[model samples]
Target: MKIAVIDGQGGGLGKTIIEKIRRELGNTVEIFALGTNAYATASMVKAGANDGASGESAICFCCKNVKFHCIIGPIGIICPNSMLGELTPSIAEAVFNADCIKYLIPISKHGLYIPGVQHMQINDFIQEIILELKKKLTH
Candidate 1:
């Protein structure tokens, strides 16, 4: 399976996702790190991404050309001007238009709150993501 983990603003979320995927799934999946900045990409790479790319152009290009089984990241990835405007409209459009399932971690930023998202720690959220991924891959 191929999955892309997109993030920005220090890439802590993406790094954790990549690490969890690597630990739980091992080498069964190819994880791509798509960051809105170089530092974010580097962080994810160090965490265990199979490959990584940075910047809006890189995100657009990869999402457009790669057939990812799923694109996982904060909901900011699809919100234009999110991540302190690091997520441009074009990048958001590209990611939204990609032909893949999107698994977004409902992180409230800029006063944005996802309805029905329970209050939970980051570890709980990551575990939920792992379970979902396992089900998707096995089925």
Candidate 2:
């Protein structure tokens, strides 16, 4: 299965999620790191993403045109109004309009205030999503 991990800014969250996915799933799944900036993409790549891409155009292009089994990220990834240059209405619409399931980590408005740090335990959420994906794929 192919999973896209989207992030913006420093990509701390994306890096955490990517590492957890790799540790738990091993090489059983393909991970694509879609970052709003080069730093974000590089972070996830270091965390073990199979591939990585950056920029708004790359994100929009991938969300609109590529085929993936799932998209995993925080709510900001789909918010379109949060991260600078990364989250746009078009990108959000494309992700929401895609024919794949999405696993959105709960993110509150206040959570956005915290810069450079991930406020939530995305690893746990990713574990749940991975379990669900495992069940679905096994079935």
- Which candidate has the top score in lDDT? 1
CA lDDT, candidate 2, residue 26: 88
lDDT digits (tens) for residues 18-76 of candidate 2: 88888878898899999888999999999999999988788888887778899988877
- The local distance difference test score of each candidate is 0.92, 0.82
Off by over 4 Å in 1: none
Q: Give me the displacement of residue 65 in model 2, in angstroms.
A: 2.0
**Model 2 score (lDDT):** 0.82
Residues 66-109, candidate 1: write the lDDT tens digits. Answer: 99999999988999999999999999999999999898888878
Q: Where is model 1 poorest over a 10-residue stretch in terms of lDDT? A: 110-119
| Prediction 1 global C-alpha lDDT | 0.92
lDDT of 1 at 74: 90
How good is model 1 by TM-score? 0.95
Q: Candidate 1, after superposition: displacement of residue 102 in Å?
A: 0.4
Backbone clash count for every predicted candidate, in the order shown:
0, 0
